[model samples]
Target chain A: MNLTQGTADPRPANPVRVVIVDDHAIFRSGLKADLGPSIHVVGEAATVEQAVAVIAEQRPDVVLLDVHLPGGLGGGGREVIAGSAALLGSTRFLALSVSDAAEDVVAVIRAGARGYVTKTISGAEITDAVFRVAGGDAVFSPRLAGFVLDAFGTAPADIADDELDKLSARELEVMRLIARGYSYKEVAKELFISIKTVETHVSAVLRKLQLSSRHELTKWAAERRLL
Target chain B: MATIPVRPPLARSSDRVIAGVCSGLAVHLGWPVKNVRVGMALATLAGGAGLVFYAWLWIMVPTADEAARRNARRPASPIAPAVSQPSGPGAFAPGIASPAVQAQGAAAADMTAAPLPGPPSAAGASPLRGASGSSTADAGQPEATPWFRFRSMKYGKEILLGCGLLLVAGIMIAQMLGVDVPLGTLIPAAAVLGGASIAWMQLDETRRAGLVDKTKADQAGGWARLAAGLALVVAGVLVMVSGSGSWEQTWLALLSSVAVLGGVVLVLLPWALKFWRDLESERAGRIREMERAEIAAHLHDSVLQTLALIQRRAGNEHDVVRLARAQERELRGWLFQDPGREAGQLSDRIKAAAAEVEDLLGNAVEVVSVGDAAMTEAHEAMVQASREAMFNASRHGGGTVSVYLEASEAQAEIFIKDRGPGFELSDVPEDRLGVRESIIGRMKRHGGTAAILNTGTGTEVRLRLQSAGTDAAEGKP
Candidate 1:
């Protein structure tokens, strides 16, 4: 199913610019071929060093990242995001990797990536994820939401004070589900509410916690061990 | 008698202090008993030449009983003329013979008349002769017996000391009886007696036997030479001190004694050096042999088995290449590469194995390890079994596999858990050898345990290897 289809594409005139970072040459070529005309492939890299250089040089609208790569400071995908920290506002990152490991998902999301999805997603789904990330939205695979939540759902014990207690009960449930890497559709279904209602609750939770995005909300919650 | 046959001299059984050689000779030569004894004693005082002669006669002469037995065995042989002739010495004074001597003569006559079956046995009859004969035979075949096979050297020294004391007693008795023995002659006689006894001790049968074995001979000869040199030095000092002479003469005597002792040591140096060298070489050879055996065992257990597996799967070119590459890396690291730097931590080794399984089965594995454990042979076995369990999980469990490792000084435990449908242990097909041989069997061989528990949620393979005591139930997840 195309999870990102319902979202609006802000850059329709200019096809979403993308740089694919993966260690496997075959997977890079296969992903480029599958994206077709809907998305524009600007550049590609096989290592963290090359990924940072290519992303900075091309200034792609969205970078499809792999969670594990061999060289260049050795933090895998997190190294690439941290290396190009100045470009994160204009250029977004969406992690696409073969690993479904909770640590890998939490690690990349905490490094300012907009979304995380396994490599098992269809070509249409991946294209939609790239457009949504370019449009300033967070996307995640269904099961991976729990890892995100467990990693960053609440403030740590020392910081678990008035800010977290300000969130309403409904807003708190929506915040936990979204920080856990759940899609808006998943959070709405789990809480028996409308998608619009889920989004409203998430916005309220973010405003109360003074967080900027779902990625930050997840990190803030994880530091508090709320999941 | 019509004819007289010449007979070899025999030790007479009667009138014997030790072997009766002097008494028998006195009888045969028709000399006065007192004259023969006095003459021999005087000869011993002159130079100890008489002692050497006595030792030789002791070896050559057969005892009276042995001689008689030989005669009886050959009845047709002509009898000795001396036997037919009446006792020559002391024949006129028959009353002087002791009752013991009469009894001995009667026993000898009775033995002569009996027809014995074999050649005359010298050593077989006398305990002394039996001991001496066996020791000499042992000396001939040194390798056939241990070095300490006989304690004869110690006993021989005791016997010599007794002989020297007896000579001293005789001198005292002679002086007390108002015989007026010259002090000059008595002193020389005592020196000669002591010298002869020391020389006799040098020919000990056990020492001769020790000389036949290289290691034993070196030790025995070294001590013997040192003792002899020290004795000679002491005697020379005594002689110089007793001689009331000039200081220049005493100085000359001391220099000669030191020179003699130095010469003896110089002669023994090469043999001692050779023995020391042999011992060192033997120790080195033993160490080399042990190292070679250890390397062979390691190759047989790991590398050789991998090579055989590769050969069997030649039809599958990918598996063959993978197996070949892994074996090559392992062998090269073991043989040529220095392990000091690249000795992998246990967690790293387990992660590497997991990577290999992932490549083989095309599945993702997450390895979570805590604590750095000393990687020993037992830990190696545990790692190998954990790899097998992971492979089985990826292939059959049909889901992402998770490997957890907890290691401490007391034990190392690895858990390979898969979030797939669990099955009973008995449900495994009979033909499948992966779980049975690779995981369970490997753990058991390492004095450890492998338990497969179907927890209803997922299958967990727990491999535990203890270093010291019974298994601990901690760290269960």
Candidate 2:
């Protein structure tokens, strides 16, 4: 696997810059309170309206955006849903909702969220989402990940159709994660492969199957349960 | 427009005016009851309309209050016993006859109480006109007060009106469409249809439920009545306009105009309201009946089945009674929108239940709650089943009681898990109600089913809800 510790951007140096935008005040505060001095909560908002404003002003690296809201500012009213789509440079929105409703799961992701997770998600998982969204990586709750895969009707490189018949376990894992829409670099890192090596394996995969693009590849892999 | 007298003291029905609550408040309070209602209505308008009071009265007061009152004015004690039971004409006690017959016999009995809402002092007064749409708070108030007893048919009011209105509207529309028939030509049909519909609602419930089925016959009767009335009026018109045209032509022209006017007035009026409301009553009554049936079916499948299983397995234990107690609470909840007998809020109820069931069965039980459970069918089932499941898991499975409740318009599900020994299909105990009655029976009744699945380390019970039917059949295969 390719691993790199790129030097931290000096401009926002040291502590991770986080902004919590969950509608649940207790959850948002509890997260901030639990993360302790390790992470900085630059700003917080309880609803989409306030979240947008907070993101615009604070410009934190990560925004813990709750997918539900309470009492005004368009909690789940389908308004201002598009409000959080465009974030200032380097800032990312993470979805925090109660259920992994497909519409909602797809909405936040389509709205340019870094990740989509449910409130049932664990504290560790939530902390992971913040970092992943901030770092331009997609974070999804396990069920929510299924919803996203369902939403686009596509899976990542390693997974797709033909599972009922046969596929090696390793091949299955690779196909499933790839059908999940992971980037080549991400997939290679996850699967512990060198970039060139990943390219070679991908070429062998394409040639052995005669598939054209990654889209068809993911669809085929999903059909076989290879991923 | 006819003035309707809605049960008085329209504002703040905190305390019913004993005869004068309305008038006394209107007097000592210095405002007419009607005026107070109007102001309260205006406030409802000023704010967002659904302040709660208006919606409260709409369903509380029956539509035909005036007619009910007229019935109430009859001499008392004669029909009291029968009316008290709300049955139709011939209901017999116990071994005597069917409930339907008894109910039918008792049908006319309610007349005394039914008519009492009408003011005792307003006996001979002209019928009052009720306003059409109340402010938000007053949303469901009936727009018209019905007659004490419709000497005219009350049930047919709507169809007659609708047909008349449609005809009048059709006539107006035809006129609009450039038809030669003038507006006056449509009026008679409108009035006849309208008048007849209002006339029908004056009939009894058997007639209302469409159980009587003589409505079409009544329409014929109405037609005969209208024809006779038209004949005389036409004859009079002919004598007056004699020599203008042949007798046949004069008669035709006269009758046609009268028919049109009659249809318009009768159908387009409060008279038609009785018919319209009867239609609604029939529909609402059907819905209530369906809901009752649904509750009964679930109670049978879930609770009754569980009881049967308990009777088989362990005979009857303390836990069985506790489970039965929980089931009773659920049944009461189904019957009442708010069973004031509830000890605590829903969350507290579930929480305490989780703790109690765990202790009872000697297992760990936990509850995770989201969304409100008030009145939602899913919430009721989830809470009830979870209570039962907790007992089952603790008593049988030897695992912590875990229950999950979820609800949405399109779907609802209750999932439960308990950790202990896994259920063996081979060791099926004779008296195993936990599996039979609590889980399997309940979901089946709701058009859903329950299945036990292996959850790696423990056993999980999943109840999948069946969505609406009829609409499903429309889907192409």
Tens digits of per-residue lDDT for model 1 on B340-445? 1112556568868987887787565655443334567878988889899888888877766767654444566677877578777798897888888888888888
| Candidate 1, residue B364: lDDT | 59
Query: Model 2 chain B, poorest ten-residue lDDT window?
Result: B124-133
Please state the Cα-based DockQ of model 1 relative to the true two-chain complex.
Answer: 0.01
Question: What are the RMSD figures for all models against the true structure?
Answer: 35.1, 22.9
Clashes of 1: 12
Local distance difference test scores for all models? 0.59, 0.45
For model 2, residues B295-412, the per-residue Cα lDDT tens digits are 5787687778767766775655655655654554454233322111112333445656776775466454544332222224544554566677667667777644556433222344
Q: Give candidate 2 misplaced runs (Cα > 4 Å).
A: A1-13, A47-49, A70-88, A99-101, A149-227, B1-477
DockQ of 2: 0.01
List, for all models, the DockQ compared with the true complex. Answer: 0.01, 0.01
